[model samples]
Target: MKSILDTVARWLPGTPEIAMVLGSGLGAVVDEFTDLSVLPMSDIPGFPTISVSGHAGNILFGACSGKNVLAFQGRIHMYEGHSWTEASLPAHIAAECGARILLSTNAAGGINPLLDPGDLMLIRDLVVPFPLPRRWYVPDSPAPVARTGFTGFLIDQKLADDARDVAAESGLPLRQGTYAFVSGPTYETRAEIRFLRRSGADAVGMSTLPEILTARKCGLRTIAVSAITNVASTVPEILTHEDVKDQARLLLPRFSRLLREIISNL
Candidate 1:
């Protein structure tokens, strides 16, 4: 693994202060960087290739809003037939590459009534489903329970405040909430959405949790934002990947600007 990191370092050749993982329809945010060096995930040893729609499947190293950064154009997910450890590899590699901060962006379904499509929500905390592998989850019982409690890094309050203020000034609707992660290649059913909302989740997505936990383990400061692509209510409307992609495209610029300003201020 160290050798794999060494290989990527040879290709990218920089010590980035910040590392980012762009999710789903959010890959366009990478365009904000100058002097970008694009590296296909396949070209990087030990990196997972992304196959989902709306993800660019590349790694970028460059200057964004005056800071040296390494950005992933897409990410692997547990729901994509990959294990949680496999899904977390990129974030671990980013930390090893010397990133002081890990910033992630995703397109999620709004579960909170206050959240609407195109809203940008800053994730203050996360709650993941249990029964995870022992390597990732810390058992709660003396009987050596395989499942663990919720685990992920909480974004610093100061950074969260800065993000909220920036979004407000930019006229972007910014909300804060607990993000929930589900293993998914499928969209949630109306009943499932209702249950998650009742459980206190504001947004729901397939990726981010494993990556967040990995970044935390590696001592990287982490912050995440979700671009709400749709309201996950039991409204009987057709929900498809196409719709999610379309919504993400519509909200890309706003998401990009919010991230750009936040990075600059950091």
Candidate 2:
């Protein structure tokens, strides 16, 4: 991991203040960058390639709203036949690249009644029922402490606040709620969605948890935003991967605007 980090470090134009992981069909956000340099994830040792359609599988370094940013156009997932290390590598690389703020985005099914397809939800917290990988790291603080393990992490408060303010100014209705993660290659059944909502999940998705946990271990402040791609059986509609990608198109304009403003504010 250290050697791979060193290799990638030599390619960066400057230390990135903010890092982003884009999910599903949301890779269009990278197009908003200026002076961009893109490296395929396959070229980066220890980084896994993305097989999913909407994921571009590249690391992008560019300027957004006058802020230097690093972005992962796609992310690997545990459900994609990968282990913990494969899925969590992006967060580790972001920290080594000197990004203090990690912003992750995903396309999810809305469980909250008021949320419909194309709505944006800023994650307040998350619920992941499966066992999470344990990661250890030493911090760079003046009084550095020994390497410590992380558990039960939450999104960074100031980052989330910035997202809320951006949403308000853009005239986008932002929903704040807890996200639920499941190990999935299959879409959740109606019964499963019902159970998740009963347990206080406002939105549900497969990715994000491992990356979020990994970010915490590296001492990076993190925040996640979800684009509600479907209502998750709350309505009579059947779900399909095609439908998720289609809905993400509807989300692009607002999601891009919110992200642009957040970068400017930061």
TM-score for each candidate, following the candidate numbering: 0.89, 0.89
- Weakest 10 consecutive residues, lDDT, candidate 1? 137-146
User: Could you report the Cα RMSD, in angstroms, for every candidate shown?
Assistant: 3.6, 4.7
Which pairs of residues collide in candidate 1?
none
| Steric clashes per prediction | 0, 0
Best by lDDT: 2
Residue 218 miss distance in model 1 (angstroms): 0.6
In model 2, residue pairs whose N, Cα or C atoms come closer than 3 Å (at least 3 residues apart or on different chains), thus clashing, are none
lDDT of 2 at 104: 93
Residues 54-126, model 2: lDDT tens digits: 8888889999999999999998876777766567777888999999888999999999898989899999988
